[model samples]
Target: MKKKILVSACLLGHKVRYDNGNVTCNDPRFLKWSEEGRFVYICPEVAGGLPTPRPDSQIRGKRVVTGAGDDVTKEYEKGAQAALKLAKDNNVALAIMKQDSPSCGSLYVYDGTFTDTKKLGEGRAVALLRQNGIKVFGEDQLDDVEKELKKINIL
Candidate 1:
């Protein structure tokens, strides 16, 4: 009877980051969610047709690009679009994405200036979901996500 919650795979220690690195954390909330089978992990960057250990991408003036002179905004957009399909297919009601990431950042993405300054930007996946009326939030807003999840009853 657990409702599905979409989470960024990297946050759960998945080796799907742009550099093929994992952001392993001992977050009790995620651990509990995983144990309860409530977490549906995803990596939009990888899913969008980018390989692991790919170029480091950033959002510059609303476009996605990498440091290696590779412009992958279209790829990121495609990936984000794909993530939405997955979310919809899974009946996901809540999402917990990584903060400040080009792929998973739901709130406060980089300003694209590459000066380590972030300016309230939305990742491709987050933007698409919100546009489709799906509730998206960052990990810091787990309370809100959990609250919404609890409001739904499955089986």
Candidate 2:
């Protein structure tokens, strides 16, 4: 069986972002992975029951709050948990996440200030996945992802 790879839905061209838009990865390697049926895409926020085109949220002191001041920490947590469960269930070899997002960023998340300020931190789901020993990377790291896939004999 091919090793499954967790990937953010938006990166797979799913309209799952806060604005209902996707930041699809155009890298040929991504398409190759898709064709090989190695990608298991999920939108953490959507899995947690948040709607697409929802208000933009940022991590505010352990809580995820929307720009309009609505506390959505619970939703984020639920989403993160769901993501972790999926990863474990499928034995995902690794993850390709969207960067600078509240729920999917593996390398950076927007500051709570929401002024486009970025901070070095893992997103809720990425943190949970890491805690459970799942390797996660950003969409920009497809080359690195390829290396991991090769290591796991998925290439």
Candidate 3:
């Protein structure tokens, strides 16, 4: 049996991206895992009541703020909390988040400049997961995630 793994909806071919588009990697390796029912797709932003093609957001000064400097941290935090709940409900051990997303970003995110400047930024959901002792992995780290999952001995 395959262990549950949290995944960003966009990466799983869902239209939950920031631009109202899907980040469908459609990678054979990921698809195989999905076919095995190991994936738990999520969209933290929408789960927080935000809409599709929503305004780009980022973390600034330890808060999840929007490009306009509005304090939307509560929204993001709520989303994070919800994601955690889902993870717990599904008994997920590993999470694959979207790269460079304000809600799902795992490794790289914009510099909050609303421009094309990307720096090391973590989404609110990612932060919450780490704090709760859950193993988080960015999209780029799929290989590492796979290796770690393999060590779980859940077969």
Candidate 4:
């Protein structure tokens, strides 16, 4: 069986973002992985029951708040848990996610001010995946993903 790697659905060209669009990465490695049936696509925010074309959100001191000031922390946490469960069930050890997303960002995210400022932090799902020993990378970090896969003899 091929080794499984989790990926945010939007990166795989799924229209799962809050704006109902995708952050697709047409990297050859990801294409090869998809052809090998090694990609496990997930949209945690949707899994947590948030609607698409929803409000833009950011992490604020352990809370996830939208641009309109509605708290969505519970949904984010729920989505993280669901995504983690999927990874565990599939025995996935790696993830490539959308950067700067409130639910999937593996690096910097908005600073919760709706001011377009960024701060270094992992998104909720990324943090949970890391906590459970999953190696998470941003969509732009495919080189790192390839290195890790080679290190583990998965490529």
Per-candidate TM-score against the hidden true structure: 0.89, 0.96, 0.91, 0.97
Model 2, 68: alpha-carbon shift in Å?
A: 1.4
- Please give the range of 10 consecutive residues that has the lowest summed lDDT in model 4: 21-30
lDDT of 2: 0.90
Q: How do the candidates rank by TM-score, highest first? A: 4, 2, 3, 1
Which runs of model 4 end up more than 4 angstroms from their true locations? none
- Tens-digit lDDT track for model 3 on 1-155? 34589998888888876678757867677888888888898899888878788777877767777777777878788889999999988988889998888777778877877777888867889888888888888888878887887788542
Relative to the unseen true structure, what is the C-alpha lDDT of residue 17 in candidate 4, on a scale of 0 to 100? 90
Query: Which whole-number lDDT from 0 to 100 does residue 85 have in model 4?
Result: 94
Off by over 4 Å in 3: none
lDDT of 1: 0.81
Query: Candidate 4: deviation at residue 136, Å?
Result: 0.3
Candidate 2 residue runs with Cα over 4 Å from true position: none
Cα RMSD to native, each candidate? 2.2, 1.0, 1.7, 0.9
What 10-residue stretch in candidate 3 is worst by lDDT? 146-155
Residue range 23-57, candidate 2, lDDT tens digits: 89989889988888888889999999999889999
Winning model by TM-score = 4
Residue pair clashes in candidate 3: none
Q: Candidate 3, after superposition: displacement of residue 126 in Å? A: 0.6
* 54 Cα displacement, candidate 3 (Å): 1.1
Estimate, for each residue in 1-155, the C-alpha lDDT of model 1 and write its tens digit: 34577888988888998878767646677688778887787889988899988877888876898876578998899889888888887878778888888877887888776677888878888888889987888878777765776676431
- lDDT (0 to 1) per candidate: 0.81, 0.90, 0.82, 0.91
Off by over 4 Å in 1: 152-155
